[model samples]
Target: MTENGAQLFARLETRPCLKDIEPQLFPEGGGPNHGEVVELYGTEGTGKTEMLYHLLCRCVLPVATGGLEVDVVFVDTDYSLDMLRLVSILESRLNAGSSSSAESDEAALRLCLSRLLVVHCSSSSQLLLTLHFLETSLSSRPGLALLLIDSISAFYWLDRCEGGASAIRQEEKLRKCAELLGRLLSDYRITVFTTCHAIKKVYNGPSSGSGYDRPYLCRPWQRLVTHRLLCSRQETNSVAPSAGGSEEQSRRQVFTVHCTSSGSRTKAYRSSSFCVTDGGVKFI
Candidate 1:
């Protein structure tokens, strides 16, 4: 039967955009396209790594959960990764979903463990190993998916990279590195979720000066990214009861995530605030 305009409109309304969804906060449909690079940047402890972990969980889920049921690449350049926490989060979530008595659903949990790949890199050459991993996946059948880097800025940081480097030379190296990584990510037809760090910018004033993280920290790297997200620590709903400029436990900052891409800021989003949970990360 031929559907009328109203029927089609109703169906369209059912489709969810990135902002409209909680677990899947990125747009759908236009994906795996070549020459595309996504940059996720935020302040310190602003749920950047945790967000990637969240997406990683979703990527391995079955089609029912908007996942491709495929593999993903994770590049850990910095030392701030919690492997045990990640495992615990994945296991706990899968177990909760698996108890539903659906055998097919359980398969999602199994496939996720086997398909997920992690690479720890401290150098640019090691970063290129991601391509080799992708190449290995091609031999099986088809549909090997997704790449994620938890903060690309660490590579460019003076302390992270070589010491006593020239400013112009340093930037040039960074630019070329960005260009190189950008090409591989696009050409390979793999989704790259790269986390970037914001550089401190000083604004001079009459009274004094204040520093802020600019929207785009690296101009050269910025041009290569297909999607760029700025994540900042927002007011935490679970602001621990503390004072005296200190707390019993480590005081963690909460952040409100705002995405700016595809021409303008996206509306129709869900999350008001995300709280810290056990086993690494989970949106609460």
Candidate 2:
């Protein structure tokens, strides 16, 4: 049976992390609806992966404890999934309880981590194969809500270098990957968050002549991105209080702007401010 918009909305899962950071990013204060693809693009060290980990923590945590309590599939292409960092954030959330029993806190943390499944893919071929294997898992696990790829363009330069004289061959592989992702979105009913690199400037180099940066990905992948979050770090001298000593002040403020396109018009919500700390992403 085919479901209409209301039926689909009823079935859609909630993402507490997005709500916490920026409720305006989603329609009617709901987080990314089912089958939506979001791309988080930025230059290096813009807290992109950290933001993803925060979202992952929120997905796996219990709904009773202010989380969605759903399963997550994290594809770490850059091999940057910091288990320790994720655990720290999870622990902070658990400990913030109002005199909750110690055993309950420990149990909740265990349950949250258990629901998360991380897969590491070092090469583009491995990433493709990993997604293929995930099909069976996705079908079997109804609790799964999100599939996250840390830096979808992890192999972009590598693929280009290997292609040598033929850009067509390089693009062909990327097109196949995008097709698979689109199929997964339609077939599995899951929200996706993938990170992309900015192409307008070198990592942290000064902005070019026009001083604009854009998300860089193949056309096929671009088509799959329904919503785009542009992340950037702004240099700042202001100090933010830290859980640790004052020595750990915030060095930079991170901004994320949510953009969605309809027909030929594009609408972007105001940017949100956050800072990365040892604990996790702190919205400011």
Candidate 3:
């Protein structure tokens, strides 16, 4: 039976999308819904991946302890899955939120860690294969709500060079991968989040302006992106003190999220600020 637009949206809206992280970014009673793809793009060292880890931790932590308690599947394409780092952040968050005993906290942390399934892929082909086989796991894990890929453009330059004077083959490979990912999103009720490099615009002038950084994924995957979150860094003013001390300055990231939905207003923009400390992404 084919579901109509209203019915589909009703179902999608029931699921959550980083609601705990920043509920204000979403509509009333809604976050990143199921079957939607969200892209986080930024230059190197912009804390894009760190932000994703924060979202993942929110998903896997128990609801009783201030977490969504949903399962997450994280596919690491750039060797960016730092388990120790994630655990550190998780421990900090759990400790801060929970008044449970030490043994109970440790048990909850272990349970949350088990819910996050991590996969590593070194190449694009391997990525495709990983997505293809993920269906079984997705089916088995009914609580799963988010699927993440750390920088889907991990092989951008390599794939371009491998094309050898032709870009069609490279585009086709990415297109096929996007198709598979889309099918998975449609078949299951999960929100997809992926990071991509920001392609610098080659404009004739000093490169300091808005809308200069564009997503680098191929056209197919680009079309799948329902929400685009641009991450950038801003240095704190010397007059303002950081968490460390009154004399210390720190850098924070600003995320500007743009919704691609047709009904959205022209200037409907949402922004959030956060910093990545040893604990993890701290929303400010």
lDDT of each: 0.58, 0.74, 0.75
Alpha carbon lDDT at 52, candidate 3: 89
Worst 10 residues of 2 by lDDT: 13-22
lDDT of 2 by residue, 217-258 (tens): 678888877777777777777666777756555466655554
Worst 10 residues of 3 by lDDT: 258-267
lDDT of model 2, residue 252: 61
Q: Is candidate 1 or candidate 3 better by lDDT?
A: 3
The best candidate by TM-score is 3
Give the RMSD in angstroms, all C-alphas superposed, for model 3.
Answer: 4.7
Ranking under TM-score, best-scoring first? 3, 2, 1
Q: Which runs of model 3 end up more than 4 angstroms from their true locations?
A: 1-21, 203-211, 238-267
Show how many residue pairs clash in every candidate, following the order shown. 5, 0, 0
Candidate that would win on lDDT: 3
How do the residues 20-106 of candidate 1 rate in per-residue lDDT, one tens digit apiece? Answer: 123334445332233456666766767788878777776665565454466676778886667677776776666664456557545
Alpha-carbon deviation at 38 in model 1, angstroms: 2.3
* Candidate 2 global lDDT: 0.74
lDDT of 3 by residue, 1-284 (tens): 45655655564555554533446445553455567777888877777898889888878988876788888899999997888999998999889856889999899899999888889998888998998888878665667778999979888888888777877876767778999988988877678888887767655556646544655567888778777777777666435666776666544445434433322424345676776778887767
Q: Residue 43 in model 3: shift from native, Å?
A: 0.5
